[model samples]
Target: MGAAVAAQAKQGGAEVLWCPEGRSTETRKRAIAAGFSEVSDIAEMARRCDVIMAICPPANAESVAGLVSAEGFRGIYVDANAVSPATMASIKAFAFRDADLLVDGSVVGSPPSTSKTTRLYLSGSGEAVAVVAGLFSGTAVDARILNGGIGKASALKLSYSSYQKASRVLAAVAHGLARDWGVQDELIDIAGGRSTSYLAEPTYIPKVAARAWRWAPEMREAAAAVGELGFPDELAEATAAVMERWAEAKDQSLGISEALELLRTDGPQTAPGPSAE
Candidate 1:
């Protein structure tokens, strides 16, 4: 995602910089491939860049923001991680003390590519939001500005992802249950008759298994979002728990049965037992 955004900004004469120190080999390779000018560390990157974007897992968003804040980064800070609005709000504790502007951002869709484009939802001060939007102008990333202030983009991202992520996980569970009954194929056939049945897709379970690790934390963040809005968070919580069962198969090249084999029947009971009075 960082590579995609940097490449796009460079199309408009933006000089992209990356710090390779302490980065993983895969990350360093990608940075080199993207041709980013190397900086020594976060402090140097902070001093040299006009805008710094944080594209990371929800769990690391606050910490990453702190690193930049500690550097006294006086530029635009775009937080585009999947996190709850509350998490985002708390980051402002350290994010905006020295930073000129901290923009809440969320990405929707696949990475911007020739065949498929993605949306970058941004919300914050109008001026800062517009600047971030212009950075991707005429690029594959469609940066849309939201009217609300900080945390709005995060809220929207979690709200949309909660349904999309949790529904797919639930669909995979449904398929698992059907398989146990020797009716999985029949279930797929039943779903095939419906135009809106994404669950009907044959590759859904494998796809979930490969990405379960990454999605698990995001689903927990989604649950936080749901709970913040006074909603029952059990669905999001269950989705995270289910995804964790497939954590071992993350990004592995495996057949469907191999992926599904890790899912155990020892999960919490589906229905509550009678309470002792």
Candidate 2:
């Protein structure tokens, strides 16, 4: 979302600067080209920019926030990662020392570009909302401010992802079972007749599949957070476990690209033939 926000901020005549994670090609290149100064210091970026948006994974956001805090950086820290509400609260506590904390939870329907569409759900202190509300308005991006503190926005994001994740898991499980029964195509057709048409090769499926492989660690964090809230995250935990299995089975690395390629090229052990009457 740094790219989306930076591109939008540029359109709005806001000068942009960026501090990227050390290991990310996606963030490093995207931030520089969008006119953000490629500064290595998180403190410097936080000290200079009006807002510091943390778009890392939920598992990583706190470390990013800690880095900013360690630098004694001062600015609005907007965390737009996909995390549980409880985790957001912990980050909020960490942010209270020097920065104006805004806990943001964003869901991207597509890539972060002029050609792509995305959504940002903003929350946290009301004052933080007031300061950054105009940044998202009247642009190619769609950002809505939500009520509550810290975790509400993150909760919303996790819930949204959970639904999508659940669908993919169901698809995987059902597909596996159908192949075992020798009725994969017929089962898929029958399910399509009853379920939403979008389920038939969902547009989000590939992205989901790709992401599935690498989400185990993050999902573990999410599961822990969810469990802390007294909610049973069996589905999320199971999804993560299955993703690990898929990754190991393919002999590919834990990344979206590898997983996508593996799923595309790999064959099922149990092939579906004609259905038994």
> Highest TM-score: which candidate?
1
Give lDDT tens digits, candidate 1, residues 1-277.
Answer: 7677677777656788888766799988877887778888999999998888888878989999999988998999999999887787788765774323888899988877777788999988888888989998988888998876777888889978987887776676556556666889999999888786444564678888899999999989867765665555677788799899987787987776666667866632343322211
Predictions in order: lDDT: 0.80, 0.65
Q: Model 1 compared with the native: what TM-score? A: 0.70
Model 2, 161-262: lDDT tens digits are 777777776566556545655889997788777645444444544455555656777777766655665555676687677666555443333443444444
When summed lDDT is taken over every stretch of 10 residues in candidate 1, the lowest stretch is 268-277
Candidate 1 Cα errors over 4 Å, as ranges: 98-100, 197-277
TM, every model? 0.70, 0.65
Q: How close is candidate 2 to the true structure, as a TM-score?
A: 0.65
